[model samples]
Target: MNRKNLTHKAGRDNAEPVGGGGRIRPVNNPREATKTRPAGGKDAKSTGIDRTRNFCIIAHIDHGKSTLADRLLDLTDAVPERERMEQILDSMDIERERGITIKAQAVRLVYRREENGDGGEAEYMLNLIDTPGHVDFSYEVSRAIAACEGALLVVDASQGIQAQTLANLYLAMEQDLEIIPVLNKIDLPVADVEAVTEELVELLGVDESEILKISAKTGQGVPEVLDAVVDRVPAPESAVEQTRGLVFDSHYDAYRGVISLVRLFDGELAKGDRVQAMGSEEEFEVLEVGCYSPKPTALPKLGVGEVGYIIAGLKDIEALRVGDTVTKVEDPAESVLPGYAKVLPTVYSGIYPTVGDDFERLRDALQKLQLNDASLFFEPENSRMGFGFRCGFLGLLHMEIIQERLEREFDLDLIASSPSVKYEVVLQGGETVEVTNPSDLPEVFEEIREPMVRATVICPKEYVGQVMGLCHEKRGVSVGMEYISTKRVQLTYDLPLGEIITDFFDALKSRTRGYASYDYDPKGYVASDLVKVEILVSGDPVDALSFIVHRDKAYYRGRAMVEKLKELIPRQQFEVPVQASIGKRIIARETVRAYRKDVIAKCYGGDITRKKKLLEQQKAGKKRMKQVGNVEIPQEAFLAAIRI
Candidate 1:
């Protein structure tokens, strides 16, 4: 295929009709195609695996992976011209509005090669997977990489390589996949193509000529990217004659049940075949098979080396887990494929619904979302805030996205507690327990081990000092530093995940004027002098507002928490004291003064005894109220306290 021959028109005016007329036709029910079809069809398995190429587009956030994917779809005619739009694979409104890829999307494209001297043109099947670029969603990238043979390493020409770009590149290398370096956004006025090309050459150890410079936004040099995939990336090796497929991803559908996105490695999977999950050992009959032309277009079967979905009438999302293998029940593989390692959550928070009745609804929403996002973990929990779920996430952004999705998709009101990292607490008796919630901490513990992370920050050389200073304020230990280029530097640091989960990234960007890019990996746990600071409203501790902080920071953090609570809590009939304390010792306190009524206003001309009597009576009533009355903490107070 050539770029010059491709049309950039927006509508169907440039589109050719298939077997039917130009009129659109409704798709039949997918489950109706259960009968096995005859062999030797146009399927890729029959055509030979050499004509197929599986690859994924990986890059940092907002680096044009989605834009490049749009151009590829246009060039290959995989999408109808009328249906074309920017970031077509990003279906979620949050994703489109945020200008970031949250979930990884997969699509199958067909490209025809130019005619050779033999007077024959070859057609190739290109299975392209578009992955998220955020550090939190890197799990999606890893799953996408596992199902591909090559990766399009997209780098911004103006900004050059970034923290996530290197992170994703390492992931692709770990998979031993072929890397096709691509410099995107080259048409921008500020693009330093020569400088970025030098960086790529030095980092990838490839000739400068090997790097392809393309403006994905303008469709320049994009066809060559597809060509590289066809020429350089190898096809899937031949597999033994056994049916096996990997469920890289899955989601729930209201009408069709669970749709498992799978990549076939061995033998074909046809509709009506009995399949069992190798991990769960649960069996189910395949209801349908299909590929995503960005949509679920039904096919007779999914052949080897193909990326597609399978409908098995699975109603329970857990029945078909991501990273689980599916094999035929009659003839299963000798052993399951090496599936992905379990991803542990790095940050934990309490997710509660404002309305108590919506607890069940929240659980249902989380379950369906978990099917789509395997990284989300949640369990039932109860506290003074009422019934809620303690949810675990990959990072703060991941937690925010899930909360937004639940509210938008499920139409439920939710309140998220302060984010915390998992900590290992050793009891005085030498028993260790993991605590994800501050309220879950035992009364007495010998030592607390908090999870740590190694963070990488890349920025211009001018901001190196500012970046290091910010990290130091967050209790970060400097690991090392290196100059990627004469003008740019990369700094590495070891910091507690607790610090990163808060406003650390925001602070870093503020310090570097939004010029620094950051990424981090878990580095296990280390013992630290940590104490749980509890917040009290009128002498009663509020479990939701309690948090763990280093002993050195407890006083300052407690002071901040109480001060913020003072401003947020509404004035009451009785004086409400907002106090932050460690154990039985109060560290900080703020008072919301009682709303006094001028009982003596009507007795302005009365004697001194009358005024004093009224004042004393009013004081006694307030004292009585203070003894029996409970302080009502508003929802906004909890929200504001967590941010503090």
Candidate 2:
């Protein structure tokens, strides 16, 4: 089995058993794992620049990006019908089951025009990159936008324009790429095509005639979508003689080592050519160069304007970063590619091995997983969670996906602490410090500046009041609010990132009946009345459970946290005191009473003095236990206390 299958198997073995009496099969068919090569390298070489078009599909979650990609594959006939499966680009089992794409997948298609058609008889190459839809994976979408010259902006006819759709549209515009607006899912009975088209026209400032209507599920109007891409989307401009390529994505293969998915800009890269990474400055010989025809297909050479994969027999995956530029070792490009932005993690948390002895295994597993996930970051941290790694992610969803992958793919159980946003502290000496964890805050600081974001919520007019109220409760400042259509409204607010990371989305869904869509971008830091709230168990502070909150909400948050802790913690031999405190003063407290036993059950026929003596002895024993014994907190309690 390949490494991917092995990882899937490890996850299945460790998780709860499926409904049936058998293990779930891996997504890829083991029998079809052989290496494939495109039709001919010489033919691909003869293909001209005008015949190539590179673009990506961008939309909100559950808006049919993957389904549209599947239809495009079918139109291009890249993969045979017998071999094709649902969500072919989503190769991971978890993604398939969840109906979401976690990683960006690329596929190259060959489109041949008929002589009798409107266009001349010729063959064209189309490269399509599928991106994740959730806001947490916006960074991935941005990277996808950077690689292509155009994008297919897909929107659900039923749902209309959403928060992520607008975010992606703006990102594509920033990249200066031509966008082809598409209204998908016209086959659904509830799809209001006219309403959606109007919304798109109003929001995008595009002519009504420019939009294409299609149903990715039934393959309706898919050919028209492809024709629009060819006629409207501009081809890549030719580059200089020196070889230049951008590594947009990568994955580790047990059989072939690290394989990089790249878009060639300037020159051609043959199978045996030596190349160096501009960022890491590491040189290696290209063992194999290939393109994805729904599967990895080896090629003799990847010419300019082509999207393909490169295998350099690289043992260290760090050398091949997502945004790094790859060039010929001997004759490098004059300058590296522009728009290479380093991914900075915004959310921080503590991840610990469920079993202490699995530390080495967990570390090695994380290192392996980090090979493909450049956005992931970690460093050793010692806290109440014991010796574990402090991990940083782009957002909460990113954090959850990494944690789940670690548990499933690595065959290890893990515990993750509460997620936090980075805080800037201005010290008394006028020195600035950035703190990822509340325990790392300095004792004396003049001001604490918390990261804020410009959050946008797109919803029906009925939910405007609720959304505005929710924003106000989170200490948000209204930026702007306007009507996109007769019934749809767009509300913008500036809110602290800390508030959004903690159940804001869930609360929004609850109040808006799941009709509201939200997105946000960092707006730098602002001075705030922030205090480090710490949770104490029997008067001892738990560093892992400490968090920063506003002074006005501290008392309420403290009370809620202590009450939750009291309920989650098990009864001990002595009364356990759970307190929420800020520095030396306790804001709220709760107590878990000790388990009492009948110490004088057999003293019914005995004297009253004898029963009293027995009870006294029991009381003394309980006091001793309370003085010396430590509270053994369960893992679930950590999750309960983390919400605050």
Best model per TM-score: 1
Candidate 1 wrongly placed segments (more than 4 Å): 1-47, 117-120
Candidate 2 Cα errors over 4 Å, as ranges: 1-45, 116-121
**Candidate 2 lDDT trough over 10 residues, lowest sum:** 18-27
Task: Give one digit per residue, the lDDT tens place, for model 2 in 1-644.
Answer: 01121221111233222111111111121112111323223233464666788899999999999999998998888989899888889998879988898988889999877756767777888999999998877767777776787899999998888888876776676566788899999999989899999877755667788889999999998898888888887776653668888787787887778888888876789988989999889999999999999888998898777899999888786778777889998899877775345566779999999788988988887777877776788998888777899999978878888988998988988888778889999999999999998899988889999999878798989999999999999999998887777778888889999999878998999999988889877778999999998899988888878889999999998899889889988999999999999889989999999999998988778579999999899999999999998897777877766555
How far out, in Å, is residue 101 in model 2? 2.2
lDDT by residue for model 1 (531-625), tens: 99999999998888999999999999999999988998989898999899999999999999999999998986858999999999999999999
Q: How accurate is candidate 2 locally (lDDT)?
A: 0.81
User: How many pairs in model 1 have backbone atoms within 3 A of each other, for residues 3 or more apart or on separate chains, i.e. clashes?
Assistant: 0
TM-score of each model, paired residue for residue? 0.90, 0.89
